[model samples]
Target chain A: MLKEILYYTWGAVVSFVLAFSVGITYMGLNRKVTARVQNRIGPPWYQNFLDVIKLGSKKTAIHHGVMHHLGPAFLMVSSVMSLLIIPILNNGRFYPNLNFHGDLIFLLYIMTFGPLGMALGAGQTGNPNSAIGVTRGLAQMAGFEIPWVMALVALMIQYKTTSIVDLMNIQAETGRWLMFSSPFAFIAAIMAMFGMFRYSPFDIVGAPSELASGPMSENGGKYLFTMMSSGSVFAFAKLTLYTDLFLGGADNLLVLVLKTFVLYMIPVLYGVVNPRYRTEQAVRWFWGWPSFFGLLAILQASFF
Target chain B: MINDKESQKIVDIIQNFARKHSLWVLAYGTGCGAIEIPPTMTSRYDAERLGVRGAATPRQADVLLITGYLTTKTLKRVIRVYEQMQDPKYVIGFGSCTINGGMYFDSYNTIKALDRYLPVDVYINGCMPRPEAVLKGFAKLQELIQAGKADGSKKYKENLEWYRANQKEVIPVWRMPEFNW
Candidate 1:
């Protein structure tokens, strides 16, 4: 029992530290990405931190019920938990003993929990704008989920195990990276995940001009900071996952950083080129034909 | 009792999402006062430094910083933009057009009160308000941010009469647009 407790405790601690570091890096990188896209210079990495602190000192107001208040709290909880699950660095060497068996699938599902909680809380608060935003968000999730699941499942089949550690190990051995062997599989996966990350084109949820930050309309102070941090860390984890999975990680820290940054640019570039997807269009296209290919990849690996 | 680092980090994250990274400006630049938006945003006022930037589309922003005047014609677009904006959104009336109609009180071209069409969070005064007045409005918004005084979400839900007033015109239980739906 003590050993198990120590393992989980270590997991949480490691995740927190790693998430913090990568969060800073991505904050800087995203600024540059957005700045380039918007024809302006974005703020420094530490700028995000300063803004959060300033808002944390803002006035506090409670909405509808204790539930509305709890919304941000729950959102933060889910985001941190999701961050804790990604197999960053050599941490995957700990494998099934330390981590859950079906962690990849679990992590993906848990990832949605934070956003879902926020949406639900938005519903409870009863802001029609957010209500509309959350509705759109849920629809988009429904759209992209099939393609995402299909892409990951295809990869999972190739590794012949749902354990993320095993998948990483499989990649480590092949000398044949999945992205190189099956570039289509890789692109499809990234696109779906990228959409889920809610940058630019998929930014229908808190479209500030439209929904006034959507479900985030009511949050301020510490709660506001919490969401911002969650967003940054979540994006970091997402990019790291792509790097670790698709681009292949190196033993050297600099190599790993470089790979992550390149991978990060894919979505950022996509954002610059693409316009925000109307909620209905995002959903319709998400569940459309591209998802079919992802499903095909999975079936090919599983049966053929 | 709040020793949970996880929750604390989460709270910090939520706050940052609202304040720091993407301060979404509402799309509709209605009223002649809407002209001030350019200087305040692009260079002179530099709202960008405060993480305030205009979102070309409504679905991407959080703060709908309305500049002024709601002409009857523009009122349609203003309501449409308000509707276009996604959740967790905020509405600010930039000038006289926002509060009880700045100078268009007697003119049929302008809506008497901007709030009559949409919920207004902060109202900055002046015929064509200076950027300083706009800054004060932003500061007041910052206070709301500081105090965490966000009843906009809850109040909007429980009693939507205010938002309804913005979305539709009420004509004393008569002469209202009849929807066949």
Candidate 2:
């Protein structure tokens, strides 16, 4: 039992490290890419690393209350938990610990954990902007989750299994990834991901101009550092989950990185070129076409 | 076989390097000089190349750029912001107004010398420093930070009493919270 616990703890650590490094690196690249797109020189690839370290190395930190302190911790837990549950490689031998059957439903619940924790923390700060940002974030989350859940339902129904490992196995056996098989679900989920990534058009929650970074307005020093790192880890978890669910599960680390990076670019590129929508407009956008595509995916799964 | 002093020095060097590279400026536009910030941030100057980005709040920001002349009213808010920021923070007295109130030097309500109330790490002496001069000021701050010369936060902590007296004198209706470093 002790051995099993130790192994599980070790596995969790490895997964956390992997998600954090990849996610932060992608964020740095996103900045560089955005800068280049605007015809300007950008910070180096290690810029995010420096920012994280500097924030962490701050000599002082402030908290509104216990919840404020617990907020980032909760966010960290959710991301780490999600990362642990998601399978990175198709081969079972290397990462066999957490890829259990009947985990799709659990994954869905855990995915919402970070935002809720963040909301609680933001609420504790007594900042009106943070409150407004939280409300918008939760609303946007509700908007996107409908289509996202529908897509997940369609996938589970089509595959006749809730285990991510089984879904990945089915792809390997049929030699056709779900992205091609259920193109409608892929489209729906990808659209939902635009909001999930919190880029342009859907970044109303943290509208830096209007909301002053929303939920994180009061967080500074080590608190902000924790939020930043947790955000990166959560980003990786979501990307890996999508890569596993829609794209075929990767067989090797390099393939996984490439697939995740390509998937990561979709929302980022869209964000760069678009203007933000108001809260209601974003909700309307998500519920409109994305929901329709999700329904179509469900229909496709049910029929021929 | 490194001694304790040597290891501490190495860590300090690393921290300084990281701090120098990443300077998150709080987006608090106090005066007309705020106009120059957009050009500095956007493609024309591209402050991101120097690892300088605009932070939305005092807590997350490392540098407080007092853009121009500070009215007595605005000085209260600026002091509040400077206090809320975490340790190792720096303030740049941007534009002539921030240095000596520039065009507003004789204005009764405006504070003439920013350094009297808060520690000024770098002073850019233009009526309104252009984006180029602003970037140069940032570069200077970064150099000060890397060389372990930027101790503005420390100075503020040490002279909190005197600074508060100055602040209280300016804003007689002083309702600002007691700064605890």
Candidate 3:
């Protein structure tokens, strides 16, 4: 029992580190790519590392209450928990902390756990912008989760499994990636992903121009640092989850990075040229074509 | 073999280096100089390459860039914003107006100088400093940070009463929160 516990703990740590580093690097590359598109030389790839360090070192003054303190903590917990649950590699190769059957449903619920926790914290701050931002964030989550769930449910029905690992295994056995098999589900999920990533046209939650970063308007220094790191970790975990589900799980780290980076670019590049959408517009957008694709996926899964 | 003092110095150096590279500017654009900022941040100049980015709120900001003229009316808000910022913060007085009021020097509403009201670390002199000048100001501020010379926040803390007095003299209705620090 002791050995198993130690091994799990070690694996958890390794996965957390890997997720964090990859997430931060991806964010840096996102900035670089955005800059290149605009015909400008961007900051170094490690600019985020320096920013995080600087934020961590700075001191925070004035807290609204205990919830304000716990807000970032809650976000961190959600990110790390999701990271642990998601299989970093196929068949428990490097670190299989917790990849159990029916984990898909659990993963779905746990993913939004952080934002709800954040809303509570933002409420405690008494900042109107934070409240506005939190509402927008939750509303956007509601908008995206419809198609996201539909896509997942379609997969579950098609493969007759609710386990992400099992689905991945099925894909490997058949030598057919799920994207090609359930193209509509892939389309719906990718559309939901645009909102999930909170890139252009969907970034109203933290509209810095109008909302002062919305939910995080009051957060600074160490609080901001924790949020930033958690965001990076969460981004990596989400990318990895998508990779495992649709892209046939990678055998090694190199393949994993390549696949994840390609998936990440879909949203990052899309965000660069497009302008932002209002909250209602963004929500309506997901409910429109994405939801239609999701329904199609379900129909295809059920019959064919 | 490092003593406590030696180790402390090493930590300070690292902190300063990180802080220097990442300067989140709260551009308190109080004047025409604010126009130059967009160009500086955009494709042509790209201030971000130096790790200088615009921050939305005073809370997340490291440098308070006072772009252009500060009138008696705007000074109160500026002070409030400055106080709201978390420490180890720096202030950049942009344009000649911030330094000595420039064209607004003769105007009764405009404050002749900014340093009397707030600690100015680096002053960029121009009636309306261009994007290039703004980048130069940032580079100067970075250099000051590296040398451990930028201590505007410390100065504000140590001489709070003096700064408050100056602030009160300019504005008649002084109903601002007390600077606890």
- After TM-score superposition, the amount by which residue A165's alpha carbon in candidate 2 deviates from its true location, in angstroms, is 0.4
What is candidate 3's TM-score against the reference? 0.98
Using Cα atoms with residue i matched to residue i, what is each candidate's TM-score against the true structure?
Answer: 0.68, 0.97, 0.98
| Interface DockQ of candidate 1 | 0.08
- Winner by DockQ: 2
Candidate 1 chain A, poorest ten consecutive residues by summed lDDT: A90-99
Candidate 1, residue A303: how far the Cα is off, in Å: 5.5
How well does candidate 3 score on lDDT at residue A192? Answer: 95
TM-score of chain A of 2: 0.97
Clash totals for all models, in order? 63, 0, 1
Ordered by lDDT, highest first, the candidates read: 3, 2, 1
lDDT of each: 0.67, 0.90, 0.92
| Number of the top lDDT candidate | 3
Q: State the DockQ, from 0 to 1, for candidate 2.
A: 0.86
Candidate 1 residue lDDT tens string, B72-111:
6666655555554444557777777677766667876667
**How accurate locally is residue A115 in candidate 3, as Cα lDDT from 0 to 100?**
93
**Ranking of all predicted structures according to TM-score, beginning with the best and ending with the worst:** 3, 2, 1
lDDT winner between candidates 1 and 2: 2
